[model samples]
Target: MNSNNEGKMDVLNNIDDQFKELLELIEKEKVSSFSMKHFDRLKKKRKTSKKKWFIIGFLILTLISMYFILLNEQLTYNIYFVFLSFVRLILIKKCVNTTEIIKQSNITFFNFTKSIYLNHLPVIIDDATDSWPAMKELTLKKLFQLFIEDPVLAENDLCYFETNIRNYNQAEGADRLFNDYINGKRRSFIGQWNNCKRETLKVIRSYYNKPYFLPPSVTQTLMGNWFLVSAGFHKGTDYLHRIPLNYDWVWLAQIQGSSLIELRPKHPCETICSILKSVTLNKGDLSNDCFFLAKESYWTR
Candidate 1:
């Protein structure tokens, strides 16, 4: 009788253990459900906030543009006001899941103005650099040689370059960077030689003329050009460099080598559209690859 009573007690304890485990499992599931619901609510709230701000900003800009148009009686001012209104309307109305990098083998000025300027899209103009003397007569080795010959460039002329793990946003002498690259000291730094002196700019222009497809107004602007140079690296590598954002229209002409260019929408458009659109700029049959970016287009290389 005693043994039988002990067995009964053991069964009761086993049942209690099972019940406790079941309760714990239910509690865990409830906590998981609560967490997921909270995360979703936060996500929705953030998205809604972004959308509200975008609308508010757009309305403010529209009012400002209209005010300017009313204040100025000039025909040009009125036309600009109208154009900006139309562009903003398109920006607000369109919601695209994915964006593309359009390639045009032979893009005319009107088409360029329509697609890139008015529509504010990113475009690649293929064979666009065929007319450039740099395409025909210049080589990367020759370009380096020219830089070496220039005293300003060979000595103290400053150039922006990508820093390694220790530093970012660095500028160093072009000569030193080139020397390190040549002597196997450091080949990882990618340099951008921009804002050249007048003499240096003159030398550069001799090799490349203004793109023929640009509107007359665009060509007249002296915003200058940027020369991006790096020892080639494979994609998905940390050694690759990033180009900075610009306020005005930006164009890149690939002198040598290819780059995977990725463009992101401006902050306001981020909620409505996809995050990134990429195009590979290659030196195909043409002398070089060329691409253009609207003033609002954000890009990285």
Candidate 2:
């Protein structure tokens, strides 16, 4: 019986030794796996660092090449200047052709639609406001009188008064009293009136209609439900400066004034300012207004 007990104890000891060996093997495997993972991470980081350095080196090389080329007077004169001049010539030719096409096509409703919606171009339609009675009745004198009678129309904080050719962004703007602005000819302009309001002047609202030349689809899509009006005594000086808008389309009607308009293509490389088209708009003429439209995706400032 004692021998039997001793044999059982020996068997148990052997099993215990085997279990400890297995545990040690598993621990070694875990260590090996952890080391492999750490090595792989280090390798990946090295590769990423190399890629970054390569990109930086490539950029530095390119910039150095450009600097050297620019420094070489003969190369700059022959290559850079020649290429720029050629590009400028092409742009000028395109501008001329575009202007000629606009003049030949005339400013009909069909042409206006095609130009804005289809061609994605700017167009000027003469005498667009001739039919409106406000053109004859809504003179500067009448506008001043209306403001005087109804001060509420000019009481809005958004109303802007410009005293010089410099835009409000470049210089400080003031909210001049409507009565004072009209009474004094300080060569200023008053604008930023929301004519769509119910309390808006009746005279101003009388002529507020959708541009007859605009297609129904365009007006509906762009929400052409409101008209914004600006009145000023900018006879000799340029009053309206470049004002960028996020709207898909803009229809500017010179209800009772004449001004010179300079249009720049959205693509800066497409045309030079010297060769760009300049349009002179005169009130009472059939082409007193212009429409500028751009596709939502293609629109620039």
Candidate 3:
């Protein structure tokens, strides 16, 4: 009995010692893991801090280089004068007479060919868009629906937007515009969406008839569709502005809201022909129902 008891005591002592060693091993392993994790975090933070400093240093160097270059060339003086000239032009306000744009109502296609086109003057045809179904059928909601169906059209991501009416530099996507306009998420001004596919143009053309004023000799070298969506006022601010001159003739069909259209001749024509014409176009019956036919010779808004 004594021999058996001694053997059992030895076995119990060995098990307890093994368990203690196992716990010590586990504690050492946990401490090692914690140290490794702490070291990794410190390394990442240092890398991020280094990257930020590098970017700041690069930008400072670029600006200093640009300043020295500008100083050497005396280009800064030229830039200042150009800016001063623009400011001077804006400050000078003259109460000059603005001529009313020429309007021809109920005119036959022959008269349009002779008077407007031959003379190369911008005119408002009050009855030109009378037969266009788009004047009746097209709405803001319908315009969004037209392009939203095709998965391919949604990929048209490079859309021009006017953040401020005076500046047309912002760019966004048509899909974003559709979403913003429909969901009432954001207020935006949409500009030209050019280079439309033939299938897309065909769909849009079905809503509107071609102008009868277009001469039979006129050939369409390029077909384009521009969707201009705006609330007339952006963020409750108003500024006088003009559309940049497009070197081609443009027929603007105002399907919905009223816009004040102003036409002025090119800079060179300012001396000889100082004619500035302004007109208001509203969509309705024959009298107010009008659209603008802008010639290449004028800058219009």
Candidate 4:
């Protein structure tokens, strides 16, 4: 009976030793897995650092090459001009294609709005103002006669009178002689008149009828509270101002005279100090008058 008890105790001790060995093996495997994860993370970090260094090195090399190429006196200016010319040609081609599409497609006001909204591109519609009574009656002579007859319209507070026809520099407190200015220098003036004012509304109603191509639905969405009448005497005069950045769209109708318009793309990363494209509009050419619809993301001159 004593020998049987001793054999049972020995079996129990062997089973305890085997369980401790299995626990130690599990601990070693946990440590190995942790180390492998740490090594993988380090390897990934090293690869990212190498990629950044390679990009930096490539940029430096490119700058050095450009510097050497520009150092040559004869090729420097010529190369710069050549590159500019190439860019200009590409822009001109784009303008020509756009113009051709408009001419060929017979784009109406509805389609024009759709195209601009969907593509966010600028468009020029010719002969848009042919039906306007202002096109036929609002010559420089007739405008002066109308203003002379009505002092209120001529000297309204909202009217902007400029001595320099070329720019917006106002003639500091200069006497506004309507007849003299119109007859003499024929300088341009912009009058703020809309349908809200009874007196001006009468005048606007006579000549500035709603465009036939514009649907009533589109008219409802337009910012119609303010309407400006811009009259200029000189040929090259322009009103240059940046459109408010918040505005998504703008339309300019040329009432009279010829104009040269230049436009450039606005980019967040770059300053646009140059014009990308320039187009000249002449009287009764292309269209009797033109309407330019532009996305506010474009800078116009």
Q: Rate the local accuracy (lDDT) of all candidates.
A: 0.55, 0.47, 0.52, 0.46
Superposed on all Cα atoms, the candidates' RMSDs to the truth, in angstroms, are 25.0, 16.9, 25.4, 16.1
Model 1: pairs clashing at backbone N, Cα or C within 3 Å:
none
- Model 3 misplaced regions, further than 4 Å: 1-98, 150-152, 155-162, 165-172, 187-192, 195-199, 219-221, 232-245, 267-270, 275-277, 284-301
For residue 235, model 2's alpha carbon misses the true position, in angstroms, by 9.7
**TM-scores of all models?**
0.56, 0.45, 0.51, 0.44
- Candidate 3 residue pairs in backbone clash: none
Q: Count the backbone clashes (under 3 Å) in each candidate.
A: 0, 8, 0, 1
Best by TM-score: 1
Candidate 4 lDDT at 141 equals 53
> After best superposition, candidate 4 residue 260: deviation in angstroms?
0.6
- Candidate 2 lDDT score at position 30: 100
Please provide, for model 3 over 1-301, each residue's C-alpha lDDT reduced to its tens digit, 9 standing for 90 to 100. 9999999999999999999999999999999999999999999999999999999999999999877746543244345434533543443222123244567677766786455443444566667777877777767766666568655455454333343433334444555666666688654553444534655555566666556655433433224555544553433223324444343345666677655545554442344334543456565212111112221111012
Model 3's lDDT to the true fold? 0.52
Better of 3 and 4 by lDDT: 3
Instruction: Identify the leading candidate in terms of lDDT.
Output: 1
lDDT of 2 by residue, 66-115 (tens): 78876664454346324533544354433334442132223556765444
Poorly placed runs, candidate 2 (over 4 Å): 1-97, 100-111, 159-161, 165-177, 184-203, 217-241, 267-277, 285-291, 294-301
What is candidate 4's local distance difference test score? 0.46
lDDT of 4 by residue, 1-301 (tens): 8999889988888888888999998999999999999999999999999999999999999999877766654355445434533544344323322332132124566675445323334545566556666667776456546655656554544333343333334553223444655667644554332223446445545655444444433221222223333454333334434333222234445555655655444432013223334465443222211112311111011
- Enumerate residue pairs that collide in model 4: 127-287
